[model samples]
Target chain A: MKVNKYITIYKDMVRQIESGQRKAEDVLPSENDLCDQYGTSRETVRKALNMLAQNGYIQKIKGKGSVILDREKMRFPVSGLISFKELSETLGKETRTTVHRLGLILPPSEAAKELGTEADEKVWEVVRSRRIDGEHIILDKDYFVKKHVPLLTKAICEDSIYEYLEGELGLSISYAQKEIVVEPAGEEDRKYLDLGGFSHMAVVKNRVFLEDTSLFQYTESRHRLDKFRFVDFARREK
Target chain B: MKVNKYITIYKDMVRQIESGQRKAEDVLPSENDLCDQYGTSRETVRKALNMLAQNGYIQKIKGKGSVILDREKMRFPVSGLISFKELSETLGKETRTTVHRLGLILPPSEAAKELGTEADEKVWEVVRSRRIDGEHIILDKDYFVKKHVPLLTKAICEDSIYEYLEGELGLSISYAQKEIVVEPAGEEDRKYLDLGGFSHMAVVKNRVFLEDTSLFQYTESRHRLDKFRFVDFARREK
Candidate 1:
């Protein structure tokens, strides 16, 4: 498949922004200037700028061009189903993953229903916590259907399960449905995360599917309230 | 511009889901059945179904076909910028909107910076709360630029401000940037919303813009922790 020219431009500009070469609050060059510099049409330049705005890299001011937003404080794209290893590498942060439990078991009825599993079917359960800068801010509890992921181990859970699934197993993740809400911290959250006396936590529940339209995984990620933030760029539907 | 044939199918199905005509857990007709019913091709029906899946209206299980999710329990779509009046009507509930405060005033410096307002300029501040079945569940604080909306009235505030803006003023709302976080409920939240002794609230901060690509409004919507839920459909980036 041939990639669009505008996507190439978008990736190049985003790479500059993420690598600290383009500092926050720095104003991007005018569209005319960018088109001239990149040797692309004005429409292509606008497409790249729109992608930048949609991904939360910059804010477009009316007359001032696109100004880089301060993504330094909390720069995680919760919109996509990205693994912790991929995310930490993107941010260039020292992150550690610890697997508390890894085994096959009968999933909860709710999880089973969401994962489209039968009554007797078993699924792989993985409980892990992610530590970024020495704080266990995220606790992830995941259940994968045995049909999709037949094998699981503690070592893979501690490393990257997504890598094993996508790279080694050659499975393609298509899309996911996610729900975000705030709830009182459960016992498991307190046990795994450093809550800092916070009684509430932000919970993201996800139902992941494969390219062939099969439900593969059900996950619940609990984040300490003070450490949780979700940013989204949305266009009004026509 | 011509709209795609599949989009027409998508909108019709979405209307059915929103109106409660299509009940939750109801499995939609098979692609072949839908194609025969709508006089369209299988590809067109699949496209409509895919749109439904992307917008959180349905979930497609591999063997079970597409099953409508229970959207009645929590139906407000915080994923996109939607007015309360438009949302409540879709839910078909006896919703009431009360204006707590409405006037022109000097916005806070932070809000001014986000809205790109002059230091000496004034903005319209409207504070309102939403009640569903006599339970106040939401509180909204909005600041609009005076230049964009030159007229404001208490009647319009109590009614639908979005309607007045789009219909009467012919203003076009294009997009918004939103951030969601959980914060300890303040006195205002406790007083305005029936929080039921919950200490935490979900705060959605929004910056809205018009079709001309100019920032026009800054809003903060506070919801009772138990009453808040955000659903989103996300596609993975390859």
Candidate 2:
């Protein structure tokens, strides 16, 4: 596959920043210098820099060039339907998933409504706590329609349910609608997550659908207030 | 102007939902019936229904039809660089903006770092509180580089700074990077907003750039925790 020159430049710069070669507040070389170095046009360098700025890697100053941004906090992209296992693997951090509960139960009213299932329908409920660096930072409560996800186990819940659904069951996960709000810590959250005495937590509710437009899963992911950060890049519509 | 059939259908359905003709939990007509009503193909009707689902208007069930969703809470699109003025106008509700403070001051250290400006450089500081439905729900603190803005007035801050910047200053607003985090309510928030005794608030920090990729503005929008909700539509990357 032919790669775009600008994307190559962007990836190389990301590598430099991630490897600590480009420290925060350090301004990158001038566009002219980068153009000469990469044998590309000024427009190409600007494209790469724009990507960097959009992804929160750098800040573009009017006259001072692009300065690296501090990326110590984990950046959760708001526009991707990514799984927890996938995200942890990308971070390469010491993470552990503890399955607090895994069972088939009658769907809760809210979950049943969101999943478009009847109240009497059984749903696979999985409650897991995510511990990163020995701190429980996230508590995820997931409900999957039993008609679609017929089989689930504690082992799969501890590992990756998305992997089981997609890789093993061959379910085609297509799109999702997500809502994020700040809510007071619930009893379940307080019991599972090490909230560090915070009174509120960030709740991300997701209604996931399949390729056929069938609602299959409803997830409520509760995160410690201070441990949660969502980053998004938005372009102004003309 | 010519419009696509699917878009026309989508708009018509949106109007129906907005007018309360379709109540929450009401099952929409089946695809075949919608196709006949709109005199369009199944694909076009499906396109319209998909649009409705993606925008949180409805949820599609596997064997059943689409069901309307309750949209009582304001849905803030997480992927748009829209101003609060525009959003309020769209909501068409009783909204008021109060200018708390508007003046030029030395940029704070954090604002200076985000805007890539020196601490000595003066920046236009605008603090405004937003009241919707007779409740003070949001407090916004904005800093604009004086070199780019040149002039800012309390009236502009009270109305809409983006309108003034684009309409009068002739500066093109291009893109923004946003970070959403939950933080404890600060003194300013308590003083300016009716936080309803909530200890935490959702803070959205935006770094806005111009067409030339120059970071010109930094804004911190603080929202009452219970009054904040963000909705997004995401597709899986195969």
Best by DockQ: 1
Q: Write the per-residue lDDT of candidate 1 for residues A90-176, one digit (tens) a residue.
A: 679898989998888885654456676887788988889999889999999899999889999888998899999999999999777
Residue ranges of candidate 1 with Cα displaced over 4 Å: A1-74, A109-113, B1-74, B109-113
lDDT of 1 by residue, B1-238 (tens): 7978788889999889878899877889998999998899997898789768756678787877888865433455667778888888766889888898888887565444567688777899888999988899898988999989998998998899999999999998877777898878887777788888788888888888776566799998898988888877776766
Candidate 2: segments with Cα more than 4 A from true spot: A1-74, A108-110, B1-74, B110-112
Instruction: Put down candidate 2 lDDT per residue, B38-147, tens digits, no spaces.
Output: 99999789878977875667878889889887665436664468999888877778999999888888855555556778768888888899999999999998989999
Error of 1 at B34 (Å): 12
Chain B fold agreement for model 2, TM-score = 0.69
For each candidate, what is the lDDT?
0.82, 0.83
- The candidates' DockQ values read 0.46, 0.41
Query: In order of the candidates, what TM-score does chain B achieve?
Result: 0.74, 0.69
- Give the alpha carbon lDDT tens digit for every residue of A1-238 in model 2: 8889999999999999999999987889999999999999997898789778756688777777888876654366644689998888877789999999888888555544667678788988888999999999899989889999989988888889999999999999977778898888889888988878887889889988786667799999989988888877666744
